[model samples]
Every structure is written in C-alpha cells, then in structure tokens.
Target: MTKPAVDLIIVGSIGIDDIETPAEKREGLLGGSVSYACAAASFFSHTGMVGVVGTDFPQEFRDTWSSMNIDLEGLQTVEGKTFSWGGKYHDNMDSRDTLFTDLGVFETFSPELPENYKEAPYLFLGNIHPALQLHVLEQVREPKFVLIDTMDLWINIAKEDLEKVISKCTMLTLNEYEAQLFTGEHSLTKAAKKLFDLGTEYVLIKKGGNGSMLFTKEDTFLLHAYPLDHFKDPTGAGDTFAGGLMGALCASGKTDKESIRQAMVYGSITASFGVEEFSLERLTKLDRDQIEIRVAEFKDMCKI
Candidate 1:
C-alpha cells in the first residue's frame, strides 16, 4: 500500500517512564505526551512523532514505535541522557505521585518538523511548553485539524503562552482540573467557555471516574466512563484518549460535530484499554476488530 502523506504529527514529551503500582513496582516504560499519544495514534492511522530523547534512551524503546508502524523520523536524540520519570500509583489507581524527574535531553529540546511531516492534515500538540506548541503550529504548512492538550503547570507559569497556543488550535483537550487552573475558575462550564473564547471551536474536559465532557459553541456531549473492575495503570490515559479521538477523526475523514462525538467514543474505548494494563501492552494487543467491538459497546452505553 502507498504510504499516507503523514496523517497525523504528534509533538510533545518523549522519554523513559518508570512506574510504580501498589501490587507491583517496576522501573519500565513510562513518560508523557509523545509516548502515549503516538502509541494510541498508531492504532488507527499513520502517525509521525516529534520529541527529544537522550542518548541513553533504549534502542528497544525507540524500536517499539517503528515496530508498530509509526514514523519516528522527527524524534531527536541528544548527547545527554534521555528524560526519565518515576511515579507511584495509589491503590485507587487514578492518581500518582512523582518520585523523580530527570529531564536529560528534554530540558533544552527544540523541535524541528520533518520534511514530509510539515503538511500533515491532522496534528496533536501534546502537553508541553505552550510556547513550544505554538512553535510546532508555525511549522505546520497546512493542518486541517489541530488538537492541543495542556496541563496545570503551564496554566500557572505560562498562562499567556498557553492562550496563544489555544488561540490557534481547532480543538483543545484538558482535564477538569487543568481547565479550572487555566481559567482560574472552579466551574467547569465557565472554564470551558473561557477556553472557547480563547480560540478553540471545540473543547474536551476529561474527568477521571466521573466521565468526560465535550463542549462546542453549538452543543455539549458528555461521555460516561466505561466502568472497569480494575485499573492497573492510569498513566498517560488522557494523552491516549486524545490520540485515539484524533486518530478516529483522521480515519473518518470528517470534521463535523457528529464525527467529534464518534471520536469521543473512540477515545473512551481506547483509554479503557490503556488502563487495563501497563504502558502499551493492552493497546498493542488490540486489533481493529477488537477496538471496534469496544467502541460499539461504548456507543451502546451512550444509546448512540
């Protein structure tokens, strides 16, 4: 099959992840942004990645993306060590504590888009420096749809830069807490409205167990979380959601309200799988059929 002209380009954090669970503590695969985003996006469409990794970043780790058919041409390997993070998850599995962060090459990272990736139709700007997100946007020659995610860190320290990035994106996805932090408001509705005013036509607020909400100037769609018996890992779940949601949108070849709704279901289904196991094990094991089955189940729950 002929290669797609890079359906989606993901720009965000990339590094080594060290995870700890109550039942088991391991220092294996973990990080943020690009890792989770690219892992999920690889499932539905062709994807390219942009992030910084240290020389110490394992070959096996980098090879995983290529093995999954994701293009990592934009991944930069610096002279120093790869970014490493250690975190411990509570029994609840929904929250975690950061034990350590070694920025390595990611500390002074600067993104430069690849030749073939500059014109991607779909773009995902993972949580990073908001200024960096805008830098990526400036590099994109023509992106039909751009989805950007942010965190409370930038909301507190780089609010202005965050707004600048939000002003350019077509869609913005953040957790309820981040929304509140960004807008300096406790009300989610008000926070989303503020975000809409910033520039995004659509906004998605992710709530841990309570479910996720999608808002646009025209309407609102709420997606109930798929009740799971147990969750082994919550790490990178939101980024995974953004990846799957945007992946489905890119795959559907539509940008309507209905398509965004469908993409939310796709995101929830994909994230449900992410929490079932650590890292990409559950995600990698799923084929298109299995994903469709879960997505259909989510639709049934939504009465879609």
Candidate 2:
C-alpha cells in the first residue's frame, strides 16, 4: 500500500498512564510523548506516530487516532504487557510523585521507520532514550527541522549520550531546571549559551507559569504565559506546548527564528487550554478560531 505523505513525524513514548489528583484516582488512559504530540499535531497537519505499545493497549485508542486522521502505521504492538505508569500529583499540582513504571514492551523496543516516513520535513523527538532519539535522526533522509525535548532524568543519568543528540537537533527544548542542570549554570542566559555552544541553534528554556525564553547565539526572546483563572491538570502542558509550537511551525511553512517565536506564542496559548482540562479534553475541543482568539489575547497581554 502507498501511504499518504505527512507534514510531521513524531517519535517517542506511548503508554498507559494512571493518574491521581487531589480529588480522585483516574484509571489508565492513553498517554506518553507521541500521544500528546499526535493530538496537537493532528489539529494542524497530517501527523504520524511511531512508538511501541503492548497487547494491552486499547483498540479504541488506535481507532480514535485513525478517526482523527493521524497515521499510526508505525505504531508497534508487541506481545507482552503494555507500558504503564502510576503517578500522584501533589497539592501544588505542578509537581508529582511517580509511583510506578513498568516499561513492558518498551524496554527493548527499537524504532523502525516506515519506508515513506523517512522524508518528513519536520520531526519532533519526544523525551525518551537519548540513544534512540539520535538513531531516529540518523535515519531521516530529508528532515528540514528537528526539535528535541528531554528531561532532567536523562541529563542526570546519561549526560554524554544526551549531549550527542542535543548537538544534532536544530532546536532543543527543556524546562528551566533541566537547562540549568544541563549547563551547570544558574542564570538562564548562561545556560542557553552552553546549549548553543553544543551545536543547537535554538535553545528554549520553559519556566512554568513564568513563561518561556528562546535563545540563540545572538538573540533572545521572552514570552509571557497566558494567565488562567482555573487550573485543573498540568500533566501534559509541556508536550501540548510542543505540539502547538511545532504544529504551528509546520503550518507556517517556515523555519526561521521569527516563525519559531510565533510558534511559542501558539504553544503557550495551547498549554493554557491543556491545564484547564485534563488529558486532551480541552485541547481536542479547541478549533482554529478559538486558538486565534487566544493568540490575540496572549499577544495583547504580552504587549509593552
């Protein structure tokens, strides 16, 4: 079969997440790197997913992605148990305590890109094994831009391998803490310098609620978060932000710094919706008009 082309290819984790909020315990649902990426990207482009799940992964979830027009041809369903995670959010909601992780089929999984997927112009490599992200990058025959997201866990445990992947990506996105840890610098400017020196042209440091900063060797841009009155869940805000940011970039048909900056604005707006409703509920319901309204509001709020 000749598969249709896509605007973006997302490579990362896909698993079942058991979430606990202060009010209740939520049973397993679909989640992980590519899940958030797929959800956000599906809104703006022809998106495809690549990840490993196990036999226990729901068929309905697969059907949902197909229904939404996301290509899941690269999704691998293995013989063992599905990847599972259990975590409880603290009272503050910004932090969480991980209770369990059974890697299941993901432990020894390897990504095999579909024949046609190798030509995607843009790629988002969600947080996963550093070595694996690099492997995917190595296989891309014509990638125009590659964005990578990583965590403190990998920076702390696999620094060298992580460095290799960081050096290869066009842009690297991380939270404030992870950026500081990666560079051993307390100041965000200094940390970004270190990252830019590592061969990444753009380094985005995300400060929760305080907003995000984008830095290059010669330029720096700061974006304020769109304020919200009610906060429900933050489990996937960063991933949602990436989705909005990158998805918009794909929509813009450009890869310059200004396009990336606009992407950040869209990302922050998308994340505001993400925190309002749990999982993908809020994001899924938001259409282009709704997002444009929020983007205008965000721009006005950030005005000098």
Candidate 3:
C-alpha cells in the first residue's frame, strides 16, 4: 500500500475570536478548532486542514500556517465574512460566557477534502455539525484512526446524527457534562460504557483544570493537568489537546493503549501552553525540546 501524503487531516472550523478574560481582553485573534488542532499537530507530524473561511481572513495568518508546512489546499476561501466568536472567561478560567457567535461562512461550511488529503492516515473531526462530519468521512478513502470532538449544542439538538457519527469514529472526545448529558448517567465510568455501546472503541472525558480520563474496554487511564502559576486565556485548549493527542498518535504511528496514554500526556502539556496566552501565541513558539521537558516533569510529579 502506498503511504499517505499527510499524516493527519483535520476537518472543523476556522475563525477569528474576540476574547475577554478576567485579566485582559483581546479581539480578532486567530482561533478555531482546526486552527489550534492543526498547529499542535504540526509539531509532531505532517498535518492538513479542511475548513472554510471568508475573503476577510488575513493573508498573514495564511502565511504563518504555510510556514509551518501545514497543507492548506483543503482550505476554502469564500466571499463573505469569516466566522467570529466572542467569549468572556470567569476568574477560575474553567467556564466562560459566550458573548456572541457569528457563524458567518462557517454556518454554511461543507468540508470538501482535497484529492491529496483523501488518503490521510489519521483524521480528526472537530466540533462541527454531525452531518458535515459524516460527509467528510464519506470522502476519505480509508483512515487508520479517527477521532471526533463535539459540544453540548449538537448533543441537545442533533443527537441522532451525532450518534451516527460516533458509531463510525474510533474515539469520541467531549467534556464531562456533555458525557453525562448524552448518557444520562452521573458516573463517568457508566457514561463511558454507554458511549462504548454507541460503537466507538474509546471515549475521552475532558475535565478542565482537573484533568482528563481515557477509557477503553480493557483499561482506564487518568492524567492530571500540568500546574500553571498563571493562566492568560482558556480559549482553544480543548482543541489543542485533541491536536496534540492526535499529533502524537500520528507521529508515532501507533493506536494501542500505551500509545494513547502517552498521547494524553502530550495533549495535557500542549494545553498548558495554550492557557498561558490568548489564541496560539505561546504554542506557535514552542519546540520539541520544551514539550519534552514539560512531559518529563509531569512524569516525575506523577511517579509512584
């Protein structure tokens, strides 16, 4: 079999974000599920992105991604305003208020993968409409691994479609509340089991600040968040986590339980860098050495 042109393909939103945290406020920063995910994943593997943006999208942003070697052949530039979102974070930084969300081109986004991306070895379905996620899946030739991230909005409104998407994915990632709401079970273990019945091989439950849990039929792995002295903004942390996890998995070319656990640690470390600044500011400047040092520190802290 021929090797894929890219190690990973990400299908999701690309947007500009206006953020207001307790400590500061910033507007029109580069932000989106695929943006963060692709950025994090690029540190580990060859990554491609598929998402729609408007003519108003900055050319400099495009240059930055291109410099990172991210394949943007799948990025569609239409004739409208790019998707924009505004949020205000609380002091704790674990929760936020959606000040506004202008879907713009994203509202009508129909991801169309480029011919070269059709054979990507790994795929990540970002938090987009379930129908669109399924559409992208149909276009892909064959993926060695597939993971998806979803939000509460889709769960409440388009659950039937969401479940169909879940059934086809190798892994599902969502917050703790979304997991409980989807399964109607207060215990995460039961919720994970319920999700397994939905046909996904693994379920990752994200707990902001606290940590994350990975569940498979045979084992469960718990990982703690890397402690930070201060947090600047929480925007894109979850997507960054997903990117790092998928990036590590793709780079290592492994999908076993041990590989998944190691990927989670990489995810956690990358996410800690995300919260240190707004948007992808800190993450863009990171190198493998910085990531390796942090991961080593985490191992030391958690050693038995």
Candidate 4:
C-alpha cells in the first residue's frame, strides 16, 4: 500500500542553540529552521520535514516532531554533532550579534524527499543554501506552489545560484535588510519590484516587531505584527512565519491572491506566539483556540 502525500513539505536546518537575552541565558535548546517551520505548519496542515541531523541530535526533539504528526521519513542521522548556533539579543529585542555557528552535520546537509513528500502541493524551502533548495525542488513533482526563504549570506555569496532558485519559486520571503541588499533599492516597493523581475510571483518582506508587507504584480498588502507585550525570544520567528503561510495556503487548497493574503495573516498571528517564549516553548503548547482568538484580534486591528 502506498502512503499518502502530506499537505506541505519543509526542508531546512535542524540544530541545537545557545541563546542569551539581557535578562537570562538558555542552552541546549532545540532550534532550527525545520524544527520551527514544521511545528508551525503542522497546525493547519499535514506537514513533512526533510533535513539532516547527527547522532547527537536529541530524541526529545524527534519525539516532539512525532507528537505534532510531522512525517520524518526523510530525516537522516549521521556521525557528527548536530548543528549548533549561539547568539545574544540586545536589551531592546531589536538587534542581536551572532556569537558562533558550529555547522557540525549541517555543513553537508542535502535534503532528499521521500516518495510521498514528492507529491506535496506546497513546499517551503527554508533558509538554507540556495543550491540545496534547488536540489529539493528537483526531487518534488510539479508543485502547485513553492515558497522559498533566504538570508543575507546568500545574497553576498551565492547570488547567481540564489537567483536561479528565486526564478523557479512561487514566492520568496526575505527580511527588510536582505531585500535592500539583494535589490540595491532603498525603497521596499522598488526592492520588491526588482525581485519580481527575477521571476517569483510574490515577494514577502518581513519587518521584525513592526510587521510585514506582501507585493505582487497587481497589488501590495501590508500587515502589522500582532501586538504582544510578553515577548521573550525572536528566534525562529521568520521560519515560523513561512511555515504558517505555506501551511495555511495548503490547507485552503487555493493559490489565488486573496488566499495568499489571508495566509499571511495566519502566518503573522502564529509567529507572534513563538516570540512569547524561548525556542519552541510557546509554539508547542499553542492550540487552535488560542490561534483563532488571536485571529479575531488581528481582524479587529485591521478593521477588516
């Protein structure tokens, strides 16, 4: 008997982290693009994760993903240590500095999708090397929609390869700094326009704390982040947002503009929960009731 294809497949990094804020420090926390993305996506859709870990990767983390019903048929474990990142966030919670990044098993991570995952209608290529993103895209069948996320490092390093990946994706997600750096446009409108020329159907620019904006050939939509006073850590926020957007889109079974817009709102609302605690602490405990209530608040904020 053949297995069923999941609603979405997320391929990216899985790691351990040491994070510090002005008030406290936490270590040995589960932190990775796939870890957060898969968790967020699982709320609205059947999600699958494809990534590489090491022998040292914790069984607890694996158990967490399993509890979320995320398909792990594509997860590979090898001999090295799991990837580990260390960062320190400033007092204002706006900017941070990277202390270190030990790419143990992640250095050579090349995602291989399971046969069931190849038929997923939605695919989120998380912030990984552009070359690897393209490799995953190749394995999947004709995807109905593909959303790719990236960082400033790729714009500075593997730009040509990154652009190739951008040309093939349905949407691209980037933060404000990366948008300017990638397009050489001070104005976000122009930056998104420049990216449109690269062949992506939509461009979503994430503005930390402030909000996010979505741009397409025909229109643009800007959304404010959910107002939250109890914020703790911002780690994995972007990945969580991407996961929410793609998962909501898949669950809706529509790739139209209006569907994409609604999905963005869900993305922002779900991500807001992640920042309320360290790592996935807040996200794992979240349920549909909390999300729906926040969605109501989001609608009230927009008056829509």
- The candidate maximizing TM-score is 3
At residue 263, give the lDDT of candidate 1.
84
Give the TM-score comparing model 1 with the true structure, all chains together. 0.96
For model 4, residues 42-160, the per-residue Cα lDDT tens digits are 89999999999999988998998998888899899989999999999999988999999999989988788888888888999999999999999999888899999999999999999
Cα lDDT for residue 67, model 3? 74
Candidate 3 global TM-score: 0.98
Residue 229, model 4: Cα distance from true site in angstroms: 1.4
* TM-scores of all predicted structures: 0.96, 0.95, 0.98, 0.98
| Segments of candidate 1 deviating more than 4 angstroms | 1-4
Model 3 over residues 1-304: C-alpha lDDT tens digits? 6777788999899999999988899998999999999988888999999999999999988987887788898999999999999999888777899999999999888889888899998999999999999999999988889999999999999999999999999999999999999999999999999999999999999998899999999889898999999889888999999999999999889998899899989988988998898888898788889999999999999989
For each candidate in the order shown, give its overall lDDT on alpha carbons.
Answer: 0.85, 0.85, 0.92, 0.92
Ordered by TM-score, highest first, the candidates read 3, 4, 1, 2
- Which residue pairs clash in candidate 3? none
Model 1 lDDT per residue over 196-268, tens place: 8898899999998777999998778888888788878788888888898888899898888899898888877
lDDT of 2 by residue, 48-157 (tens): 79899988888887876786688988889899988888889998787899999999999988988887888888899999989999889988887888999999899989
Stretches of model 4 off by over 4 angstroms after superposition: 1-4
lDDT of 4: 0.92
Question: lDDT: which is higher, 2 or 4?
Answer: 4
- Residue 284's lDDT in candidate 3: 75
